[model samples]
Target: MSVLTPGDWGIEALWSALQPVWPGLSVELVDEIGSTNVELTDRLRRLAVVHAGGQVPDDAVLPVLLVARRQTSGRGRLGRPWLADPDSALTASLCLPIDRADWSGLSLAVGVALANALDATGQHLGLKWPNDLCLRDASQPLGRKAGGVLIEAVNVGHRRIAVIGFGLNVRHQTVPDRPTGALTEIWPEATPPATLARVMPALLQALQRFDQQGFAPFLPAYAPLDLLSGLPVATTDAQCPAGIARGVDTDGALRVQQGERMHRIVSGEVSVRAHATELPPAPGH
Candidate 1:
């Protein structure tokens, strides 16, 4: 596969690309999202107003953008290391204003939003837990993970912005494995920037949809894409290690039946199955 001559993840580039699209979007350079949020929170403590929409108020929440060349230390749920080569991944943080009252695991809804955007790229994508978008192998019956989405909250004074990030493996499939390449074991082209570019519009649209209805609006679309639903599987959380996936809870948590008890799995290190096989495992493996 052909990899692009790696573009620098500079603040200027991010600002340049976003300024034309987001009206008043601004850019900030940082080593990592964690540090970026820290700095944002510090600035917010002083009470700064971000002018957005209409009628400028005391609370002006601007989107402090962070694009890393390569995150020396990146994190996912339960602090999993989100290590991806600088060029192989897309790591971006956009500070967006959100309501505090509805901050109960709202990331799942974002996953659904991202999934809807991925669907427009001509690839069948689905949502998987707290934050992940997976591409399914339709012929294999059960689908698998293809990419990931991560969201963080940065509360500064009266402004609370969600620091949303997406780590998408556009070209390289292994480690995260590409569904098409794994099935075919051969690539069709050098690289796919056109496909990757589709993410920008997807993200913008998803965020807008998320604030309106949370996951309730996307449940019908998200259900069929549920990979482990109705299947004997392992929960990402070891607390309920042995159980079958019952699907997601109303709040977007994974539901698994452990013996006679049904428990909602908020987190777990998931794996479809680790072995040498081209086909999905049997129903009750």
Candidate 2:
């Protein structure tokens, strides 16, 4: 595969590479979008309406892969702005119907899949619980954030649709208020289209496996890449006291050891700073 330059992503190139891997998959490339996640969510809503009206087959799964060269208003977890240099980041969303009742740990599963795909290039990558991809090494105590996964679920009739969004920095760019890392820093040949080509198939396969087995099948795979294991951590939940990170349980909830008690945190922003020092409170406290 030839190395692609920055801003050189092409629909034809992406389709040619991904079509054989994912038969019948639909791909859309746009010059710019507010957010690929938002676009796919809207499309899924319209599809649900059409299905409800009996215009489309009920059992049909609408799988869409949308990629954007630039995102004007990309969003991360908790509605935080996901800013990246135009054409220098691989911003994409995958929307598909799944047959799972329990969606817990899907984000973690995605993180594992992404780490597996990128780590093949000889970069040691680690995952922060839930879904933050980081470049980790013995030299750097705190891992540098390289990418993230944001998942949103929409229920249509008895089926659930997932919109999984990915934002990976292909090149170094200024990310305000956070320490950022880029794939090109480790693999200088990395490019948006090439990175997407490597990651999308792995992600789709992982999602399918997760729908059938849930997060149980991914625990062992996630353990090695878990960056927060055996570390002091704090959470956005004010009532919850600081605790030692004990990895995730079978159900995907983060397990934090607070004194003699273990707390199963379902959802919150977790930080691995100092042992008892609280992180600056999130907006609205």
Candidate 3:
């Protein structure tokens, strides 16, 4: 494994490498923030307000990327806190304007894109429905979570901007009350910046495609990486019953087989373990 200092993950270095591929793309790197998602949301709101008032130029590009060395109030799905060591994780968020009226399956599409990108770097990552990246093992087929994605939308004028946030564990570190895994476990030489450079382009491409084609196009590619398929699982919601996981639908809903019927789960936290049992701690990232 190689050691990485904060100096190695410079914003200018990343921008220089990415500019050719993503021409005119804006990038910002901060030492610390409450949350990238929160920051981007606020920015989008201000942009929308300016655009609405016709005070902004018409030639401005739509997407902006923000990377943070540390997050004081990082968040995950269902309001979970995403905690990580400043040097051990890659935390980033992208604010992108979209034309889609229904953004139902964007999270699943982003997961597929990220999994493909990591695979290109010689790491086998799996998708745990909606938006979790997993490191699967034979004994723990559901896999230990290596990372996660959270997508939030803000309306800017008539456009909807999706704030896509991701947190990936790059090196080994202790995460209190969570079963976390790191990319270094597979790619020992991986660094936060190196991993980001590899994944960002793929993620951007996927988001663009998703804005045009929705989740249907990524269904086939996502199947091999789907970790919950054919497993008995339970939902976090008390009213939802436990069932056997049957993979996702075209719209990214989890299809769970309950008794003689198949039920579609559009949203909620799920676990492979029975509903009554306690779920293993998940990675804060």
Candidate 4:
């Protein structure tokens, strides 16, 4: 499919795709197929902040969610673009009224809820810190990065609005040059978009709840899905390219035990470079 700009949002196609799946849910989708999820949300937030108390601009759509059928350049955290194919994923965003709240935390909460949704569908999904979903193949438990979440902050006066982006793999496919996987590979018969619709309500509800109670309420919710909690790992800043991830801190930074000191990395990509089968020979070797 060719890329679509926000101007090309054909409501009927967007509506047809989701109406059957997300019935009764208030989802206003735009047809911005070429937009990266992160950029799209940031644009929405900026518009809300810029035009506060004024009528919505002609080119602006506010307080509504955006879903792309063919997101040509959707991106994830650490500046990774989703290798989005029209039928393989759900590239979407949600808008919210942001105030003094660190509502960005909801991204993590949504990830956890999504894990629960996958579990409900008989899929065992694990969670990588910050907000990536993984699936472990018990026989070969080393897993794959299946999905990711992106959150951008938009200011509305003293208020901080947000546009949250999510990209999930629903088919048994992989992006040619990225470390991403899809649930359909694990569940051959599952409907990716339908699964998204089934799983999104809980995620939205959890986000709403967190907006009210803060991320504290979601700790228990996210704990079970923690994929590398105690596993020795290294975290790397996609930009700086160097980090050692020991574990997560109470505030969510990736902790790295380097000799006598431990470094907590709040932002970066953590890849499972060394799995069970690839252990070093011995201390002397």
lDDT of 4 by residue, 1-285 (tens): 344444444444545454443343345554446654565565766666678787654334445566766688767787777756666676777766544355535667777777887776434787788888877656433367778888887654445566778878876565565455677776675553465555666766666677777666667666667776555555565432333344454445555544445566666566654543232322222
CA RMSD of each candidate after superposition: 6.8, 5.6, 5.6, 6.8
Greater-lDDT candidate between 2 and 3:
2
Q: Evaluate model 4: give its lDDT.
A: 0.62
- Which ranking of candidates, highest lDDT first? 2, 3, 4, 1
Which ten residues in a row are the worst by lDDT in model 2? 276-285
lDDT of 3: 0.79
Between candidates 3 and 4, the TM-score winner: 3
Q: Ten consecutive residues with minimal summed lDDT in candidate 4?
A: 276-285
* Per-model tally of clashing residue pairs: 6, 0, 0, 5
lDDT of each: 0.55, 0.81, 0.79, 0.62
Error of 2 at 49 (Å): 3.6
What lDDT score goes with residue 264 in model 3? 85
Query: Candidate 1 — worst ten consecutive residues by lDDT sum?
Result: 181-190
Off by over 4 Å in 1: 1-23, 27-59, 121-124, 137-144, 173-196, 236-241, 259-261, 267-285
Ranking 2 against 4 by TM-score, winner: 2
Off by over 4 Å in 2: 1-22, 50-56, 59-61, 121-123, 137-140, 275-285
- Per-candidate TM-score against the hidden true structure: 0.67, 0.87, 0.87, 0.72
What's the lDDT for residue 142 in model 3? 69
lDDT of candidate 1 over 1-285, digit per residue (tens): 333443433335545665655556676444334433334445554544443333435336665555553455566666665654545555555677765456544676666655665465425665566576666666653555555666666555555668776555544545534352221212223122333344555565555666665656666666776766756665557687656667776667777766667788766654444332232432343
